[model samples]
Target: MELDLLKEAFDRVAKKQKQSSSKTLDIVNQIEKEIEQAITKIQTTSNHTSVLTELKDKLNELAPMNQLDSNQKDINLALAKYTKLLEKCFQPDISRAYRNVDTDPHVLNEIISTHFYRQGLFDLGDCFTNEAREPNAASLKLPFVEMYQILESMRERDLEPALAWAAKNRGPLTQNGSTLELKLHQLQFVEILKKGNRDEALKYARTHLARFAATHKGSIQKLMACLLWAGRLDQSPYTEFTAQAQWEELAHELARQFCGLLGQSYESPLEVAISAGVQGLPTLLKLSTVMAGKKEEWQNMKQLPVALDLGREFQFHSVFVCPVLREPASEENPPMLLPCGHVLSKQSIVKLSKSSTRPFKCPYCPSEATISQCRQLHF
Candidate 1:
């Protein structure tokens, strides 16, 4: 009886193994048949457009054909080859495939879907190591190579140059232009910030947010988003930006949002850190004071980017709305007097105070103190 039972167990195991092997072979055969058919059709094709269409249609039908157990490596290899063929045939138009990943991006841009097939979208700022193993990855080779080296030299805090350049370049990206170029810029910008340039990253974000707001007036979300991004740059663009009327409102809004830490983390270098000369310091102090009142209101209004200039990362930092106060010193330079008890040869407090809303409160202390209560930091 024992001998008979052991023999029966062995027979059962053999049968199971045979069934598994059979299923795998069936799938493998299917894959080979499909690939052979595609290859023959592709070979007979003539026009590049026709070739691309055939390849695209076949991809549409057979793509993600991941069910075939034995065809995994073969399918990957085939896709690599197929993608390469299309790339070579339509050098400029090949990017049109990558366009939807950018062209009609999702509201949140989740970046994953059945529609996403191009491998280039994954090339987010990874340097080309010239891995001869896969020639398939050499998509972004051009003036972008020149720009990448330039960006590597700048400090993390100063990557705006790269983003600005990329944003500007997005305009002419078409059949003749390189989409990879702008893509590299956005990727590099994000990488640099994630590494260290947190402030610049915020600025990059705000600029994009503002540009979006201007384009899609309905997107209040984008407006708040700019505030959130600028909150990261914490460095004041107050003086330079406030020189214009429309920008003044945006600058004030941004400064208020940033000070409150809206849509940002305190540990993220979007800190309250700032640079203030005697003239600039008061504006910051006043801003701080004014913002102390309605902190929650600003926090609730995080802006989102509008669908403006779809491909280009729109980067207008401030919205144009209200007139700003940037009066020059009436007299060349005067013995500076301030309620802050600091003095310099900059300008008189009387005229400077006129630039603010509540000329009643000293910018430094919001105190009702006059020049009598002041001291001179620099004589």
Candidate 2:
């Protein structure tokens, strides 16, 4: 709805601008034509005084100044209206939303440099780190560099580099429930099959893919079925197996698994932070406006007054809300694991135990435990 309003305003401004331009152009052209005709008459005829008087009369009759003033007035009115509409719709002043907080410059520089490196912008990362006097930040680029190299190889349908990396990290990849290695082998087997080499495709599959048969029986069966349409998989019932999306998805999966093994997130941390900030900015701005006079309270707040829906991607951890108190757990009142395997806020446990002087029955079970038996849990 807001976009529609903006578009409507923009269209009005554009229409007015075009109309004003056309009108001004017509008036200028008319004036120029009159002046040219007057000059020609003056040059041909010896009556220069008469031509001058006639030209002066023609110029006054055209009234170029009046027409231009009218056009300018209309343009100014439209511009002023458009400017006000923009200001009203955008609420451009964001100064009131800002809150001053101290941040470590070194950490911020590192994050910026790391973001560049993770994006495969090694030169830019190096330049930034050098300019920031943190040359050690360049060390972060090596891992991402190798990741991109493998991705480049995969883009060329050569999965040797990726397969090697996957094999080297097989243990960790298995722990993380990743089948990147098997998927790479499947892509390779399909490539060989596309060459109309049934024997070689079967050989490759048996050598690399047979081990995954026990766990991935269904996928192995599909690969085996693809042998019937060797060199013509595109015409086969499993046509989707040859789609570009397969390679793209595999690349994404490989990058995800690679980042996981590096103890990093699949998405860039800087990108996630910026995206979350953008999502929550409007709420923060409104809250800042409402708390204008209570700036101290706003600044001291550990959590936002309202929940920001940053979506699933930004949700990195679980938020345990205590059922007994009907409030979320915080550092001051963290969730505690009771002996009965039920969880409750520390405050709720203290209240239930009567200040730790007595035992209390579990809120959800028949078992009882003292506050001492409840352990602090960190999520």
The C-alpha lDDT values of all candidates are: 0.40, 0.89
**What TM-score does model 2 achieve against the real structure?**
0.76
Cα displacement (angstroms), candidate 2, residue 106, comes to 1.1
Q: Mark the 10 consecutive residues where model 1 has the least summed lDDT.
A: 109-118
Identify the runs in model 2 with alpha carbons over 4 angstroms from their true place: 14-80, 293-297, 323-334, 337-342, 354-357, 361-369, 372-379
Tens-place lDDT digits, model 1, residues 195-227: 455567566546554454554455434223334
The CA lDDT at 290 in model 1 is: 52
Per-candidate clash tally:
16, 0
Give the TM-score of each candidate.
0.16, 0.76
